[model samples]
Target: MRKTPARTRSTSRSRAAVVAVAIAAIGGTTLVGSPASAAPSGDTTQFKGVNWADPRDNYADDPVVLSGLSTSDTYAQTYAKASRVISAFRANLGANTVRLPINPYTVNGPYWKSYRGVIDAATAHGFKVIVSYWEGTGARKDGFIDDPATYWPMWNTVVKAYKGNSRVYFEPMNEPHGYTDTEWADLAVKWLGTYPSVPRNRVFVSGAGYNDHVTSVCADPRLKGTYLSLHHYGFWKEYATYDQWVSDLKERIGNCASRTVADEFGAPMTTGLDYNKATPDNNSINFIQADTDTFRQLKMGSVYWPGLRTDDTYSLQKLIGNAARPWLATTNQSGADRLAWSWGRGKPVSP
Candidate 1:
C-alpha cells in the first residue's frame, strides 16, 4: 500500500468558517449534488471488516516462505501471534470480516501448512475471510500478475483448498490491473468455470484498474453470482471534496450496490486526526466519513485496507508487544470510530 500526506490545514480554522463563506456564495448548501445514488437493498447487513496483512509475508518472493523464514519454534510462535491480532480486531474494531493478503507462491506451496492456521483461527473467531493473491518475489512487484501460465495454476490450488469451506472465500486475484475490462471479465468467467465446485457467490471479482473501478465489471452479464471487490484510497484523488469523492466512487460502483463490496479502502491512521469536515482538503478522515456513509447507506460491505501491515500507516490497528502474545492498538481513534459507525455501533447517518 502507498502512503499519502495528511490534509493541509486551511486558512480558516473551523469548518463553520468555510461553511458560512461557501453558503453565502452559493445561497444554500455549499456541497451541491448528491452522489449517483444506488437503489438501496432492504438487506441492511453491513460488512464491517479490515485487511489483516502479514507483517513479513507480503515482501517474500519465495514460493515456500514459511520454511524459508521460520524454523519449527518460530513457526509456532507466528501462529500464536496471528491469534492475538485476530482477537484484537474482534475486540476493538468489531470487524466481522478480514481481507487476507496472500503471496500466491507461498500459500499454494509449503507455506499453506502454516497459513491455514490463521484462516482457521479467524473462522473460529467468527470472521469471514477473503483471501487475495499478491505478487511475490517475481519479475515485477508492480501489483500486476501477467503470467497466466503460473497464475492460473496457483489459483487452482487456492480454490481447491477452500472449495468446501463456506467461511473462507476465494478472491481469484487481488487487483487485475494488467487486463482491460473485457479481458478481466473473461478471466473471471473462466475462473468460475474452472472451479465449478467452488460456489460463485463465494468468489469476489475485482474491479478493473488496481481494483479502483467496478462499473465495467458490474456491467458484465457473464460475471454474475459474484461480489465486486473495490480498493479506494485518499491518495487516489488528492484534495478531492467529500461530494466529489463520493460521486467518483458512485460512478465506479455504478448500479451494483447490493453485490459490490469495498474489500480494500483506507488512509493514514498514525497521524492524530478526526474523521470530520474540519480537515477537509486531502484528509483521510473526510475520505473515511464519506465512504463509510456510502457503505452504510447503500448497504454495501466495506473492509478496511490494512489491519496490521507492519510499517504501513493505513493499518487500522498495529501489532505491539512480543511475538509470544502480541498486543494490538488502534492507530487512529477517529478512523476506527468511523469503522464502528459503519458497522452500526452508533446512530445511522441518513443518506
Candidate 2:
C-alpha cells in the first residue's frame, strides 16, 4: 500500500492510542505484550518473503493478460512462467512466501479461471501464497470498501476456490481504511463465518487503519487462529530515527508478534544504501534494519513489498528484457542482502 498523508498516519496513531486507553479503562485486558500463538514451522519471524506483481500492474486488476502468461494457454502452460520466477526467488533470495494482490472483480470473471494457475504454480513450487483483494480505483481513490454487493461475492469465490489448499491464504481485504477497528473486526468475523470450512490459520486479518496498527485486532478474541497482516513503509515516516521506528513498529504489533506477519514493507531499491550501516544517511536502510531486527526479536515473519514490478522503485526483482518472469535486480543489493540474511539459507516454511 502507498503512503498516505502524514496527518493520516498521525491521526491513525492518535486514534489507536485512544482506543487502547478506552479498552484499559473498562478493565478489559489489552492483550498487549501477550504471548502470541506459534507460527507454522519454518515460518518463523525470519522467513524471507517477497511480493510478486502481475506484469500488467495497475494493482493486478487489468483485464488484459500479463506478458509471460497467455489468455488462451492451458493452466500448465500459463504456470510455466510463474515456476521460472518462483525458482529465481528460491535461488536468489531464499524467499519462501509470496504475497499476491488480486483484483476483486476478476476472481469470478475470466480472470479467475487463469489466475488459479498462478496460485497452483506458487504452491507447487513450495511457496506460501497470500491472496488479498484490491478494489481497482477504490484502492487508490479512497482505500475503503464502498460496495459489499460486489466485495462479498468476490471473496466467496476466492474461499471456494482455495479453501482446501493449505499453502494458499485468504486476506479478506488489503487495506480497510474506511472501517473502524470494531467494524473491521466485525467484517473479519463475518468472513470467517462465511467460509466455515476454511481453517482460521489460513486467513490473514489485516490490522486497522491501512493495516498499520494491530492492537485492536489483537484484542479481539474471535480472531485467534488468524494471523495479523501488517504493512509498513519507510516513506510513511521519512524522518523517523531507527530507535523511534523500532519502537513504533513494536507498538504497532502490540504484542501479537507470533501471530503477525509484516506482509508489506519496503524501501527504495535504487538508493544504493547499505542496510548494515546504522547511520542516519538513509532512512530506507534504517527502516529495513529496524524491521528486520524487530521481527527477529519478536519472532515474526515478513514479506517485502514488490519483489517484482514494472517500474517500481522498491521492487526486489526487475523483469529481464522481454522476459515475462523476473530475475533478481542488482539495483537493491542492500535490501536484497537484508532479506537474504533475515531469511537465512534454510528451506522456506510453508505458511
Task: Give the alpha carbon lDDT tens digit for every residue of 84-185 in model 1.
Answer: 778888888888888776665666566667777677777778888888777654345444553455667777767767777888877877766545565566
Q: TM-scores of all models?
A: 0.81, 0.82
Pairs with backbone N, CA or C atoms under 3 Å apart (clashes), candidate 1: 61-137
lDDT per residue for candidate 2 within 165-269, as digits (tens), equals 888988888877655788668777767766777777777899987888888987998777778889887877758777888998998987787778888888877
By how many angstroms RMSD does model 2 differ from the true structure? 7.0
Candidate 2 off by > 4 Å: 3-47, 55-74, 138-140, 321-330, 344-351
Model 2 pairs in collision: 45-300
Model 2 scores a C-alpha lDDT of 0.69
Q: Give the distance in Å from residue 125's predicted Cα in candidate 1 to where it truly belongs.
A: 1.4
Mind sharing the TM-score for model 1? 0.81
- CA lDDT of every candidate: 0.67, 0.69
